[model samples]
Target: MFFASDNSGPVHPRIMEALMEANQGHAMAYGADALMDEVRARIRDIFEAPEAAVYLVATGTAANALALATLAQPWQTVFCSPVAHIHEDECNAPEFYTGGAKLTLVGDTDRISAEALRAAIEAEETRGVHGPQRGPVSLTSVTERGTVYGLDELRAVTAVARDYGLPVHLDGARFANALAALDCSPAEMTWKAGIDAVSFGGTKNGCMGVEAVIFFDPAHAWEFELRRKRGAHLFSKHRYLSAQMAGYLRDGLWLDMARQANANCARLVAGLRAAGMEFLHDPQANMAFPILPLRTHRRLHEAGAAYHLWNGTLDGDDPDQPIAARLVCDWSISSDEIDCFLNLLRA
Candidate 1:
């Protein structure tokens, strides 16, 4: 059973097939491929933003960093939660891409609140030229802790940013998972909620390595294209990325894969609960952070189950002590694997 990360999962057969089909003939390079046009059209249709500017990158960092750089100026600071992926996981790529823009951490938890965001934004740009100016507000759906920001919560936070004339960016590294959990339409969760841009994830769900950066307003398109090219994220063999995304968008496979992953996490959560494990945070999507007995941790490790030990260790002296672990469910994970993992816990 592999639960270390959704990134570890195999690519969907449809995506691989699409890649093979795309390789059969020569295509235009540098985002000029015919498949890319189809991908862009499909994304615009899905998001209901016919005017949206869509571009692909091989990594989520590129998608987020370039998108943020498009919205933020070097003299400004981005507002985000303390545990946002842009803050904790991106290795300051946003800062690099924006030419030294800083990230101002907003809430104490993984999800930011409207009041906290307002306070953070207000606290910035207070010192005039001495301090950083207010920039974009970045929100992470299916936040690092796996909790999703509800529609109203998103609206409130975006409204706060809007009050200060700051643009909004969404780090949707698990967009499909969050979408399935929220049961909201793509448009409702994003532009309608006042999001200016989004990093529409594909890798973590099932595709090989394709992420889309979508801007609801086409005004940012040229700048983003220039930034992407300057940042070296512009893929030369562009059809491969286009094929992966196109296959993902077709037949509603993206949502179906996400639904399976979320269902797997729910099953894992149920089994963990039955085993008397305590959750550090709610399992809102496809990730879970559970605190279980140290002995159980040893048992799972010895049984060849792969996952992240979030806290403590297997070799600690206190066998009965609880340790935190992160379990991620992917679309390909089978129910039998889940049962086998649960059995290991019971053992």
Candidate 2:
């Protein structure tokens, strides 16, 4: 019943074993290890991008910030949804890494529309040197609100960026989850959709802590390498990161984990519907945003269930009032756990 975050879940056993094996002998440091070569090649094959430049970091924030820094200049502003992870959750790391580049909120919703993005891009650079110039467009899949963009939607947004002669960056912090839900190839969701770079995330799926930043064109490879090192995100024992990703990608473990997570979310959604809860967003991938009665929330809390309250606290006067809850299901969440949670809600 611990739905606090996928971040709290345990690392997959295979990933842990891979880490143990990687620690047995000496290896090159700072991403020069042989394991890193396998990771690069594997990601390239997965994305059908042979020339893509792939680099690993310990956090999704570092991945997004460095990738954006490579695509956008300091004098420019990045366009993104108002609730994008890069905007709301990254703590301005993107601005810092881009050397003061600004973030322009494109739409009021968690998902940005093509029209909204075009208007936002046009709104920028209208003042010429007086205001921030238009930079790269960043789109988040499996958006903060738990909804995903279809392939057509992705193409539309990226097409809008292309019209403005802007590169597009995808903040795919839940890349595997989105891919599982969309049932599309990595290429279709990214480069094929006109994305210039992607923050290929792994941590929120099943890895311990590793995210890959992949540039489809490879033109900004050196710049990204320099920025990563300068940003202090370069890991000395880099093989550890490599081993985790290798184990994750091996035997399609990444997809399997994502499938299980998405299935768990669907199960939870069904249970929530049975309990007569209202969803704040469509349940997609591994996340669900639902509004439950305050009385139900209090029961769950008293039963030691852990999860995040998205909108309101439990101290309100009306016990029947509805408040939003963000429930995240990882690969490890069991049917029994979800059943227990559902049973509690029913009670």
Leading candidate by lDDT = 1
TM-scores for candidates 1 onward, in order:
0.99, 0.99
Q: Candidate 2: how many backbone clashes? A: 0
C-alpha lDDT of all candidate models, in order: 0.94, 0.93
lDDT of candidate 1 vs native? 0.94
lDDT of 1 by residue, 83-161 (tens): 8888888898999999999999997999899999988887887897999999999999899999999999999999998
**lDDT tens digits, residue span 1-347, model 2:** 99999889999999999999999879999999999999999999999999999999999999999999999999999999989998888899999999999999997998889999888888888997889998999989889888999999999998888888999999998988999999999999999999899998899989999999999998899999999999999999999999999999998999999999999999999999987888999988899988988999999999989999999999999998889999999999999999999999998
Instruction: Score residue 345 of candidate 2 by CA lDDT.
Output: 91
Listing every candidate in turn, what is its Cα RMSD in Å to the true structure after a full C-alpha superposition? 0.7, 0.7
**The 10-residue segment with the lowest total lDDT in model 1:** 119-128
